[model samples]
Structures are given as C-alpha cells and as structure tokens.
Target: MDTTVNGEPRVLATDAAVALIDEIRRDYPDILFHQSGGCCDGSSPMCYPTDDFIVGDHDVKLGEISGVPVYISASQFEAWKHTQLIIDVVAGRGGMFSLDNGREKRFLTRSRMFGGGEACAIPGVQKVV
Candidate 1:
C-alpha cells in the first residue's frame, strides 16, 4: 500500500515487505530504508537501524513504511522524482551491511512513472526549466 510523508503519497511497500519490516522491528525498534543507487548492492533497498546509518544532508525523505522512514539520495531523487517507489521483498541476500542480510530475503525497489495528475499532487516536484 502507498505510504505518505506528511500526507503526501511518495512510496509503497508490498505485504511481504511490511511483514519483514515488522519482523526486523522486533530487534531494531528504530529502523529506516535507503534506496541504493547501485554499486555493491546493485540498486537494492537497504534496511538499517536508525542509529547506524547517517543520513546525508542531501538525502530526501521519501516516506515511511511501517513507521520506518525511507530515504533516497538527492542525486538519485533527481533521477527518480517522477516515479513512485515500491519496496518489495524477494528471496535472496540483502545488502551486506543491511539488517535484512541474514534473513535470506532482500528488499528490492520497483518503480512506476507518475501520471500527469499524480505528478502534480506530489510535493517537491518542479517543472523543468
């Protein structure tokens, strides 16, 4: 289902992802997600304890899922701002450093471009100059 930040829809998470988040929460009460823009993890969504990772100044808070804040880098956001991010759980290993690594299920990011009306409804979207 769609998750919003301050009532503005931004991201979505599958039921399996929500269940995994719930399970992860049992250990790390304060957790968050960051959409990796390739490199070691190859664009997977990484989950971490809130205290473990430092959110950069340029990071954008997309939304929250299961009460956990989700973020993406400003550069990544610029490239993906026109789309809605959907977080899904798939059978595999998570990012090496992510909390979900040992669970054998990784968080994947899937997205779809926002429709005209939907684009207008999202906050922070700007017209190309």
Candidate 2:
C-alpha cells in the first residue's frame, strides 16, 4: 500500500465549487454529495443534507470535499473506479432534490483516469469490489 499522505482517497472540488458549497453550508452545515449515474442528472454531483439523505450499503465513500462527504453507488463506482472525480461549478439549476438547486449554479463532475499503480494505491477504496 502507498503510505504517502497523498495516497489517501480524495475527491476534489474546484475553487468555485468549494465557494458555492460554503455558501450552501450556511443553511445546511452538514451536507453530502452523491454522484448519481442514472438519468436526469446524468452523473452530476448531487448535494443533500446529511441528515436527510441515507448512504446505502452499496455506496462507496470517495472521501470528502470541503467537509462534505462524497459517495457513489456501487454500480457507478465500478465504472468510475479508474477515474478521479473532480467537482466543479457551472451555471444553471442543480438537481431538484439537491441542496444546490435554486442557487443559480450547480455542481458538475469532471474526471481523469488514474495511473495504473496509483489507482490501486488510493487508500480507502475496498479492493474487493
């Protein structure tokens, strides 16, 4: 295993995205993000109140960005396992059920394929699935 502090699994949020999340935090101090793979949002990162949303057994924790925990469904994780998720902010409304809605800007997901060894070395990822 890679023992470097940087080896820890990380989810990145752009400055603009972090700023928006901070603004939303004023009202929802404990918010979480789930990158849905289904339709409607089409892989957009969705943010919700931690108390209001439930992280399912099949979900995987992808570390947090700006104090907000980020999760992805098992099925989605399978497809995204080789990629690093980068959260970004874009103009427009967010998901209807997400906290970013009505904020005039929404969170988006960008990614980069991980280098072979780095992918396996990313801490906090379950090697089994």
Model 2 CA lDDT for position 119: 46
Cα TM-score per model: 0.83, 0.82
Instruction: Give the alpha carbon lDDT tens digit for every residue of 29-121 in model 1.
Output: 999999999899999899999999999999988877767888999999889887778787889888999999999998887776766545443
Worst 10 residues of 2 by lDDT: 120-129
- Give every collision pair in model 1: none
The C-alpha stretches of model 2 lying farther than 4 A from their native spots are 1-8, 116-129
lDDT for model 1 comes to: 0.79
Reference-based TM-score, model 1: 0.83
Model 1 residue runs over 4 Å out of place are 1-8, 116-129
Candidates' RMSD to native: 7.2, 6.4
True-vs-predicted CA distance for residue 16, candidate 2, Å: 0.6
